[model samples]
Target: MHPSFTQRVTALEGLRARTRQATAEFYQKPGVMPPPLAPLIIVRSSGNNTFSLINRATGEVIAERFGHNNATSHARELEADIKRFNVKQFGRHLRDWALRISAILFLFAFFGSHA
Candidate 1:
């Protein structure tokens, strides 16, 4: 399994686990580099796996496949993929921002209307 694919799949699974099991979070290996984003998941493949990061929102793969020989190249690729994932899913962040703005707007509107 290609380590990249393993990591990608494991990360997705971790996300799913986090959703399903409230107490569950991703486990980081003993000495692995910490993942950059919150709720990050890390995986190390043992050389026979192929992996891709599938954007669960769009059912599209965000990263290319990692075959056996390509394991060594996964770090940079995974980092780049993570960046792309964040940008592509910026809507989630935007939605949160919008919700906060709406709440403030609602409060101001209520006060303005009364005053």
Candidate 2:
């Protein structure tokens, strides 16, 4: 293999590592995109009057089409299960996204960068 190709592969691998690290940090660190809230914690959504109940791990919507009391109450009722789902779903999505991105990068490096 050519030296330039080898160098390009190394650089792409480094980029892949950094991207994976960033995604992991975004999911693990508190108060990033989705503020880490305890299960069923009452919170208000920005740009709207309706309250929001979210799975802190995935930033997914638990309930929003209901009133504050009902939404929060329902969220509390399902908190445990939702947390489990959120954790699993977060891992699944993270893995999928990372793998897809890595594969795309690999193809681009191996084929598109050929000279």
User: What's the lDDT for residue 38 in model 1?
Assistant: 35
Candidate lDDT scores, in order, read 0.62, 0.74
**Alpha-carbon shift of residue 49 in model 2 (angstroms):** 4.2
Q: Ten residues in a row with the worst lDDT in model 2? A: 39-48
Candidate 1: worst-modelled 10 consecutive residues by lDDT: 38-47
Q: Scored by Cα lDDT, where does model 2 land?
A: 0.74
- Show where candidate 2 strays beyond 4 Å: 1-37, 40-42, 46-49, 82-115
All candidates: CA RMSD in angstroms? 13.8, 19.3
TM-score of 1: 0.35
Task: Give candidate 2's TM-score.
Answer: 0.30
Candidate 2, 22-106: lDDT as tens digits: 8888878777675576555444564345777776667776567346666667677776665576777989999999999999999
Give the per-residue lDDT of model 1 (tens digit) for 1-115: 9999999999999998778665333234455554455322233443458655444445554554477445435545665666685754888889999999999999999999999
Model 1 has how many clashing residue pairs? 5
